[model samples]
Target: MSASNRPAGSGRLLTGVAWATLLLGLWLWGRGITDGSGASSAPTTGDIAAVGRPHGVLLPAAHAPIKGTAPERIEIPSIGVRAPVVARGLDKAGGIDPPPFAKSQTVGWYGSGTRPGAAGAALLVGHVDTETKPAVFYGLSAARPGAKVRVVRTDGSVAEFTIDDVQVFTRKRFDARKAYGPRKDGRAELRLITCGGTFDRASHEYNANVVVSAYLTGEKPSAGKSA
Candidate 1:
């Protein structure tokens, strides 16, 4: 049965990284990063355009080239989030693992994919809530377009991206390719993901996944790397 059609509490618990496993349909069957499709490809993934709302925040407009650096931290000043970033690999189930629930204040960067600030879509995933309370990305849905997301890298470079889109996709209709794929061939982009929408106590799952899309707008190299 489709996820949307399922009863509120009819969620399944899968093995492996519990948080990431909750999204088995996401990182596994839904990933189409190279499909070149967007939110319009299918009914399940919902409509990306519908979720993106304009905002009044001002952001840098200068675009930067990809640096391929390993991100160490992420700061979304608009939402008052300043969290350490840890490298995460997929579990045996192919689901990208998130930081342990105990580390609710941290986020995870997909070490297998394009590094943040690179010329492709970089993915960052986090938990919205744990079994008992709020987590790192708990307020991610409150972010607005034109807001800035800053990523500090191991190389000492800080990549700044401008938020332009945000949407929540239901697991059943999730189109991984369209949601994670690049919209432009060479533009550096970002996708911040976490569980969103209503929580299903019976299903032990979230009704949808929040996806925040951004693009590299500027970069500042560490003091030593600065010319």
Candidate 2:
């Protein structure tokens, strides 16, 4: 889901224009795989339920305070991404708000969902392209299985994950069951999401969303120690 590959859609979710706005704003502000270790673990039924419980819901305003700062950093040498992560919540519309896009800044986490490095599947969503310009996650589609993803948390801890799979789903066909679905093992997982698919000229947005799934390989400061 690199900025160049961002898809189109209507004024739904994060508007393409808004995405562009976010990217442009960031640029003005400062600016800034491979080899598999066997079948990656899958989400357990309970894990899936936890994520789906809040499907399409916006994060409470109270959580907005955590929107900035690097709870972690994600890197995929194969795709050339090594951005710090922040926390982001949904706007009044129940869709994720744009994440910070400045070069030195970290990407945002969905303040509404489980934090990355948590026990369950931590979810993060960003814009592939806000407008015609490339935004954070613009190159997400290039990532492949076996790529490495690193997360550095606020607690001075870091967790490493390996890319398990990359999937795309139409907005209408988006199966929340699968998007936030649980793994059978309850292993910690991460899901990075962005808009993708065909761009609808009339709608000015992408027809679908792109999703990247990864699993924790190992981490410093221990896996579930509130990092």
Compose the digit string of candidate 2's lDDT tens values, residues 1-227. Answer: 23334444211333554344323322322211111122212222111211222234332111011212246666667767777676766565444555544332246676656666555567776656544356667777666666678777776666677666676655444455455543534566778766565666575666555567876766666455563
Q: TM-score per candidate, in order?
A: 0.79, 0.63
Which residue runs of candidate 1 sit more than 4 Å off their true CA positions?
1-51, 55-62
> Could you give candidate 1's per-residue lDDT for residues 93-171 as a string of tens digits?
6777667656777888889888998898898888676555667777787777888999999988899998888776655
Candidate 2 — which residues are off by over 4 angstroms? Answer: 1-13, 16-70, 100-106, 222-227
Residue 28 displacement (Å), model 2:
36
Alpha carbon lDDT of each predicted model? 0.70, 0.53
The candidate that wins on TM-score is: 1
- The global Cα lDDT (0 to 1) of model 2 is 0.53
